[model samples]
Target: MSKDINYLIKSSIEIYFKNSQIRDISFNTFLPENRNLKSKRSKLKMEKEGKNNLRFFIESKDITAFRASINEIITFGKIFENVLNLVE
Candidate 1:
């Protein structure tokens, strides 16, 4: 893909993070490890975009795994948001 497409994707994901409040201060401090993993049927990568931004790139061999990964991420985000609310 071109740079513009890449930028667009990153921007969109960042917006989701912003709106979901997933990039809160506490979460940034304990960000996931920045690495890429490949399995027989999928790939997963987590990277820090900048000082306070994280990017997750997940690829699966099939749509089912892809959807599952997405759901898990969304669920994790919701749980984290709730925890932050509780702490504050």
Candidate 2:
């Protein structure tokens, strides 16, 4: 349930990390979330409104976060789940 569900994660990362140049994020191989992100496609909790709410499906996958203690790369694995809450 992670094929399409990943868009949320992707969009969140893309939107949040817009300043960064990381481009290897995807349903197949994303950030620390890939640790157990082996599921299916989905779009269960999207807040699509109006005509946009025409019943759409999103990709799904587990959440990933890494431990980058190198300042710029930084580490946020501790609050990774919290980050997911923000996007989801």
> Which candidate wins on lDDT?
1
Candidate 1, residues 1-88: lDDT per residue as tens digits?
Answer: 3323221111113313543245555345334422223354445555556556666677665655566556655665677678868987
Instruction: Give per-residue lDDT, candidate 1, residue 50.
Output: 59
lDDT of 2 by residue, 2-80 (tens): 3444333322121133222222222212234434433442222222223212111233343342111111122332254
Residue 33, model 1: lDDT of 24
Q: Note the Cα lDDT for every prediction shown.
A: 0.51, 0.29
**Clashing pairs for predicted structure model 1, backbone only:** none
TM-score of each: 0.56, 0.20
The local lDDT score (0 to 100) that residue 18 gets in candidate 2 is 26
* Backbone atom clashes (below 3 Å) for every candidate: 0, 24
Question: Any idea how many clashes model 1 has?
Answer: 0
